[model samples]
Target: MSALDRSAATPARVWLIWVALVVALAVPIAAAAASPLLAWRGPVYIAAGFAGIAALALQLVQPLLAGGHLPGLSAYRGRRLHRWVGALLVLAVVIHVAGLWITSPPDVVDALLFRSPTPFSNWGVIAMAAVFAVALLALLRRRLRIGPRLWRIVHMTLALVIVLGSIVHAVLIEGTMETMSKVALCALVFVATAKVVADLKGRAKRSASP
Candidate 1:
């Protein structure tokens, strides 16, 4: 796409993308809600799975949504939307983990403390730490006078960590994720990581050129 064309892509398209993602993410949640049988088996697993998916999708999409061409939209407004979405994502993670804790407090504690036998638990723990780090950076971002370049690097790194960890967790949990959907999501995450690395390298190359 030409620069002008890229710049002109409609914000409506981005809105539609976000709406579609919301519906996709909601399917598992709705399923959990509608199935009393799932609750009998232990609702926490399903609830946590839905919340994690919602948070992951929001984190992935918020940046694109903010950048999309929206008529008469101020920079401040776009950033405000980003912030709000981020806050909502944090809430989703909390709900996800809290549900897990309620269902199996000891197991949750074990996972956090690195005592869980499940290999995916290691990934989950790392991802949770990365999320906490990002949250801390966001909180202290202003007071610390964080520079744009440093913030970008840290944010991108932690985002990769989140995606990797979440994918590992999903792959290890056989029952929660549908086979095809899990594979597709993991492939997308892999591509996203590669794209971010390429973008960073390209920026470095340009900066180094005369």
Candidate 2:
């Protein structure tokens, strides 16, 4: 195709991808909202569950932003948004656990202590720890003067933990999240994380080649 034709096609393709991503992220949340589960839970519990859901949705966006895959966003802007969204993710997790604690102190305590009867609780706690570690390390990055390579390794490793642990935690629980929607969300989260990791690795390999 001619350069003009290719140029014209590019924006349309980007817009289509953006719309698809927005729709994919929206469907699961909409399904959860329409579920009977939301009505069954009290406000605090509902808030907690939705907080977790919001975090999961943010997870889908985080990697895309970090990888500069979202059209029209410069890499700098994307990374800036990624940092802000990371902070928000941490806050969502805090609200999720705190709300659950208020609703059932014993359960929250057990989960934190890794003694919860529910397997999902253990995974949630693991993910929570990984989130906290990531935030803490980010804050200390400059102070610690971490080498770029080391920082990327640490960040990506924790990211993997966050993605996997969060997915397992969300999937194992028979709670506020509707099953089909929850599954769909988890799948998308995995895909997003995998794509970013793959892209990052490929870039690293290219850079390393003589």
Model number with the top lDDT: 2
lDDT of 2 by residue, 15-46 (tens): 99799889978887887788787767899998
The CA lDDT of each predicted structure is 0.68, 0.88
Which residue window of length 10 is worst by lDDT in model 1? 63-72
Writing each residue's lDDT as its tens digit, candidate 1 over 17-83 gives 5575666555544543554455556656777767876765565555443443333345577667767
The total number of steric clashes, by the backbone 3 Å criterion, in model 2 comes to 0
Clashes of each: 0, 0
Return the TM-score for each candidate structure. Answer: 0.76, 0.92
